[model samples]
Target: MDWTVKAGKLSPEKLRSLIFNRLHRRRSDILLRPGLGEDSAVIDFGDEVCVVSTDPITGASCRLGWLAVHVACNDVAANGAEPVGIQAALLLPEGVQDEFIGQLIDDMDAACAQLGIEILGGHTEVTTQVETPLVVITALGRAPRDRYVTSAGAQPGDIIYVTKGVGLEGTAVLASDHRETLLSLGVEEAVLQRAAGFFDRISVVPEALAAAEAGASAMHDITEGGFCGALWEVSAASGWGCEVMVEAVPVLPETKAICAALQLDPLALISSGSLLITAPPQVSIVEAVARVGAKAYPVGRVAAAAEPVLILPSGERRRLTMSVEDELWRFLAGK
Candidate 1:
């Protein structure tokens, strides 16, 4: 049979059969290669493990450089590693101005500086193949052999917690990149401006580290598929299921209003700033996240149901399966 894939991330089932299972490379030093929910690949170096992850900024038009750095770094952080360095790849369209590249580099440099990460090295070129500028970053970090965490470590009895509200990156991108379109949709200027500030909330290093310190079993950054997607990934990786309370998940007022105006589901939108954590029943992961100037809440519990399920406020249960496309992509395509 002839087959093709669509835009956005592939479904988890395809990832397992078509990609991960086919990797022939096997080395004892490779502590973790790749799996359904695992983000960074861990390479053992005796006492420490090097964690590496790569992500690209293809969806957001505003602050592409900054988003590229944080999104990739978040994966390393989620693995309980200290993000230390990054390498960027930039492809610019033909006839692009030098000043634009300079500004983009400046933005990347500034963002890396904020996180105490070094710009290792990368390649940049202006080419006719791209219609717009695209930035990809590979983030590197390190952790003690015993301290590193992965999404597959969660146990059945652990509690699932989420830090920060959902739809952060998507809300920011829609408000800033598609500002005029939102205005045409009758979204207030004040709402758009406030939502645009969500860019600053896209980093999850602090909360991830805090959760690790408090004895987290697993951690996943809520990214392209929002909170629900993250919950499903963590559950799938751990060979367990989750029961999430819909009302317990935090959804910001701006996110709700913006999503409503655009006819999108906030829970299905891309949310980069949020973090999903699973911890022992007695561990206070929420308190740990709060100490880092962010807040977390217990939204679900790990179970043996064999599939992740969402519990609505009305007591309805909805099983969640990985989707090929994110709501953010739909909105962007429509725009």
Candidate 2:
């Protein structure tokens, strides 16, 4: 059978069969290898485990460079590593000016400065393969040997918590890219303005380290997938099912307004700023995140159910949507 795929990430099934199962190479020094929801590669570094993750900036156009840096770094941070450096590979479509590149570099530089990291080396070129500028960043981090957490660490009975609000990144993307459409759809300018400022809130490093310090079983940054996707991944990676309380998940008013105007479900949207953290019942981490100036609310728990569970806002118990596509791509595709 001949097959192909549309844009965005591949379904988890394909990832397991076509990708994960086919990797023939193995090494003892590789502490962590690829698996479902395992976003970073961990290599043994004698005293520390080197965590490396790469991410591409594909969805957002307004702050591509900033997203490129932070999103890449977030992957390592989710694994309880502190990112130290990055390398960028930029593929630019022809006709982009030097000023565009300058602005992009400036944005990336500012993000690096904030994180106290540096861009070591990378390649940049104008290519015919892409229609727009595409940035792929590889981030490197380190953690004490035996201290780094993996997606598979969570166990049944652990508490699942989410940091920050759902759909924060998607709200910022829409506010910046579809501002006029949003306004035409009755979204207030003030709402969009507030949402655009969400870019500054996208980094989850502070809370991630705090959760790790509090003995987190697993942590997954809510990226391309929103909170629901993250919850599913963390549970699946750990060989377990989950029960999520829909009403308990935080959704900011700005995000709610944006998603409402776009006729999208905030929970199904891509959210990069939030994180899904799992820990044993005894390890309360809300206070830990709060100490780092972040808010974390318990929204779910690891469960014995074979399939993912959801406690709806209407008080109905149901299965969560297993769709792999983010609402952002699902909505944009129909257009």
Candidate 3:
């Protein structure tokens, strides 16, 4: 019959052939287009370039509008652009109360206001086809054409840095959407509350722009595939290898508690607030990130094109294959 697929993102192979390859037409002004590791599209507009990215909110039940805005804008920021505005499409399941839409818009407004961006425009509707509310946002930003970064620009000897703790968004989703389940599993309400607060840290705009200005070689947002997936994408896109110290990857206490209670791999959990960056060893991205009130953790370095390996906490090496998948969907799917 026809092709069938899983619920999460399309695998890199299928995406390249079916999506990326299908776009045969090209424009000279479009410097950056879609690719395996690319999350945004860049269009040259004379002196400056516009970086636009589209993302949909699906995994989490709560904060749909907020997540939609931040997630889309996060992609633009990963390209080292200054986000200016967004256009959101809200698709809601039928039979929902009016209060629900109000809250969703309010959340979106709050997020946009915090980021100093506006909701330019979009469409919203209630439909029977959806079981839950879905928010899709298209965010746009601008930066000097010569200063923008890409996921495919990493080279050998570049230091790999991940900003903030991994599994941040996953921890928040579990805490907000599955609080009762976690409470029953002995997680304290305080921990859950803190986890929910992680929503505020969802945007990587400040640190990403800082890294770009610091001459970062490559940058990627840790989203669906978590840190593991982001690492694989950067390595694959850059056509290089990486050696990461597993112990050096930071995890919040609340994230650890939640993942442990749920038997989830924090490294493989969906982590949206984290940013993976690569830069020359001499560049001081640490200071640049710190200036933005964020910290950069050096967890690895880019190596020759061989294979990505993780030096486990126990000193044993494990290969990080392209097959790595996000853990959030597995739990949500009850698999």
Per-residue lDDT of 272 in model 3: 88
The models' CA-based lDDT, in order, is 0.89, 0.89, 0.91
Q: Give the distance in Å from residue 226's predicted Cα in candidate 3 to where it truly belongs.
A: 0.1
Q: What is the per-residue lDDT of model 3 for residues 114-193, given as tens digits with 9 covering 90 to 100? A: 89999999998889889988888999999998999999999999999999999999999999999999999999999999
Pick the winner on lDDT between candidates 1 and 3: 3
lDDT of 2 by residue, 167-249 (tens): 98899998999899989999999999999999999999889988998899999999876877877777677888898889999
Window of ten residues with lowest summed lDDT in model 2: 318-327
Each prediction's TM-score against the native? Answer: 0.97, 0.97, 0.97
- List the candidate 2 regions with Cα displacement exceeding 4 Å: 1-3
> Measured by TM-score, how close is model 3 to the native structure?
0.97
Q: State residue 76's C-alpha deviation in candidate 1, in Å.
A: 0.3
Best candidate, lDDT-wise?
3
Per-residue lDDT tens digits for candidate 1, residues 267-316, read 88899999999999899897889899999988888997798999998999
Single out the weakest 10-residue window by summed lDDT for candidate 3: 1-10
